[model samples]
Target: MSLWYFLIDWFAGVPTFGVLFKRFMINFAWVCIALFVMLVFQLPAEYAAIVYFGFIVVNGVMGFVFLRQRMQMRD
Candidate 1:
């Protein structure tokens, strides 16, 4: 299997903290992408705030949906 898939499986299999770890990693990746975009575009402070807020909202919603799906699959 690919290393990426293996890492994901490893993270998911962690005792007690797998879900939290996955969510954190997802958020961290989104932050990195957002920062890269902001740096490349050199957004103004106002727009940067908007972008950051949007990314946070998106990340939270995506995380929620992911958890919900996982829960459904477990039942």
Candidate 2:
């Protein structure tokens, strides 16, 4: 990668992963809120498990996507 590419957060003149990170963070925050709500409301164990698994799945997907993008950019 060029110095400019290393110092900047764009790819081919377009904004890079900041947007994707922001979106993922927002969704993560919502998942956290939902988990907190479930706890506060004493929701069923099954419901809590579902939400927790959903969070795990989302995290896994986001990590995969980020790594894929990074690999693509490296080339």
- lDDT at 43, model 1: 76
For residue 26, model 1's alpha carbon misses the true position, in angstroms, by 7.9
Model 2: per-residue Cα lDDT over 1-75, one tens digit each: 888875243223223567666756776798889988988999898997888788778666766666777778789
lDDT of 1 at 35: 77
Error of 2 at 47 (Å): 0.6
lDDT, candidate 2, at 27: 67
Please, what are the lDDT tens digits per residue for candidate 1 over residues 1-75?
Answer: 899997566444433346655766776787778877888998777876876787677556655656676787689
- Top model number, lDDT: 2
Local distance difference test, each candidate: 0.67, 0.69
Q: Between which residue pairs do clashes occur in model 2?
A: none
Model 2 misses residue 67 by how many Å? 0.3
Off by over 4 Å in 1: 1-42
